[model samples]
Target chain A: MSHNTEVLDQKTLWGGGRSPFNVSYGKLMIWFFLISDALTFSGLLCSYGFMRHKFSDTWPSANDVFVHFPFMGDAHVPLLYVGLMTFILILSSVTMVLAVEAGHRRNKKEVQIWLALTIVGGFFFLFSQVWEWAHFIHGTEAGAIKDIIVDGEWVTQVVHGANLHHNEYGNVLFGDFFFFITGFHGFHVFSGVVINIIILIKVMKGHMDKTGHYEMVEKTGLYWHFVDLVWVFVFTFFYLV
Target chain B: MERDDIIEYSLDISHTDEEGKVIRKRLWKVFWILLAVTIFEVGMGFMFAGVAAYKDMLMYTFIFLTVVKAGYIVMIFMHLGDEMSYLKKIILIPYCFFIAYLLFIAISEANFIFDIGWVLG
Candidate 1:
């Protein structure tokens, strides 16, 4: 009886008046959403792995394929540009965490500055991806020669670059996976930038100040970090591995 | 409780100059760690290119390093490390099992298909 009374007297953490996770509903929901998104990305990556393994003998080596560096005509610098992209994304993730920290202190100016830097980093990354896609679509001078059936007749032709129909790379599926996975990730970064802009505007308008908390910034920071996390996997599995 | 009251109650924003400094320091540390690991991976990739003997080892190393970087990003940047222990488990535990199972299934299936000489066809 005394133990029950003591338990009752103490503050009940899970008695329905407060969050059991010690997080706001919005933040909790964001975490759940990120988890689900992570699984979806994993599914795509695993399928990529399956296909690559199935075509192990003829799979295109990522190093040989991604050797183009801007302003270095015909230079074979493997993984350099993508490495730089990874660096930019990680740096932006740092700025995003700093913004969330500033929000914790209710420092509006710092949050705005950091968030703007993050947005700039995002745009730079998107532009780099566009440049990469352009180079990928434009094949090398010495493209691969392969046999293909056109209008019920087999023809031998030199295929340059990549598209849904075919790829200069060994397997056509490589181009498909590259387009789908990276395109999906790029879309995420685009949406993340848009969300960050909206949040920055809200901060500038003193919305967070009025609310007496910066949970919104924290939530968005979670999302931005998630994007960065996905990129890390893509960089490794798709490029380095 | 009112919605505003719930929001107010859930607000965990407590900050100080010292706390901010510590956080900034930690964030920079994670950034450097990620940068170093990436450089190391690239270096390894360059060094071991076309080395058939070390192919499996290099692939495994890359996977391990990638997971380590992911851990840092999630724990520190996403602030999952500061969340309640149960919440952390709730978010992480399932992913571990789920990814492992999916990879196992996909790889085994791919291997079976490759063995039967059906992949290229």
Candidate 2:
């Protein structure tokens, strides 16, 4: 991928020197912002890992635990439903890409259409998550995973009311963190979708075209892509392998 | 270094000139590379699943590959790579450090829980 200038490019990346080329201060600031944001997400995920490791022997298998809807009114099925949700999220990411394309061309109508699609996709994902949370909270109790050991390693072999309610899966800590982390992430996506929709409305009014800049679309696209990227990891770590 | 190169790099497929006229470039080359890498990823995901040498190790490899794909999209597709190297490093270092630190704690905490052996045998 390197051309004649590859060696020179390396001087910046390596050789203990700053960049040979100049970039804007805005772009550099954005980089720093993304860096901090990335750290926040990493910290949350890492905590999950710690808890997962502690429960390794009796840890719930993602597939098995996620199987069966809790409030399905006595239905029996597994995995297919969540798979559909994943498909929805990924497809929405594609639509966002289309919107980015349209924005580049100053295709206002096209941008609106694509943004609408992406917003719909976002809503669909959120709905799926809510359903999943309900099932997680009040659905079929997990099989492979049973009982909870407190932070001090005291196993509480008790089951009453719901899974996390009485003490089925483990102590309430898992449930607490689950709601907090996923809920926080979900809230972010929810807000991001709102912002995009607002921009879509503005684009329909021709604000971006009149201003001769589509930086809004570009910045929002970055945020959307990051959300999708985070979910890709969450899907693997939280749901699948 | 040409206009088309800049355009081609910014947009995935082709680009236009100053007058908004289409400028056909050999953009398919980049597409081919991306596709080839994606195929390798799919192959690795499936192949490594069965190796069982160390499940965690394979999982990390998969994560690494996924990061590579993401990096390509940002650097090539999003034009981030063309920016100043200082900018790129600043953004990437924090991101990597954040993710790494979180994952470290995740594994450590999970390990501590497993040692309890209170839930599963």
* Tens digit per residue, CA lDDT, model 1, A1-241: 0012123323666677656666777888999999999999999999999999888877898888888889999998889989989999999999999999888888999999999999999999999999999988887989999776678888889999888777898788899999999999999999999999999999999998887888888999999999999999999988988
Scored against the true structure, residue A34 in model 1 reaches a CA lDDT of 96
* Residue A34, model 1: Cα distance from true site in angstroms: 0.5
- Judging by DockQ against the true structure, name the best candidate: 1
* lDDT tens readout by residue for model 2, A152-223: 675645343233433244445456556767787788789879988988988888898775655567667767
Estimate candidate 2's alpha-carbon lDDT, on a 0 to 1 scale: 0.60
Docking quality (DockQ) for each candidate: 0.55, 0.21
lDDT of each: 0.88, 0.60
* Model 1 interface root-mean-square deviation: 6.0
* lDDT top scorer: 1
CAPRI accuracy category, model 1: medium
What is the TM-score of each predicted model, taking all chains together? 0.94, 0.69
lDDT of 2 at A44: 77
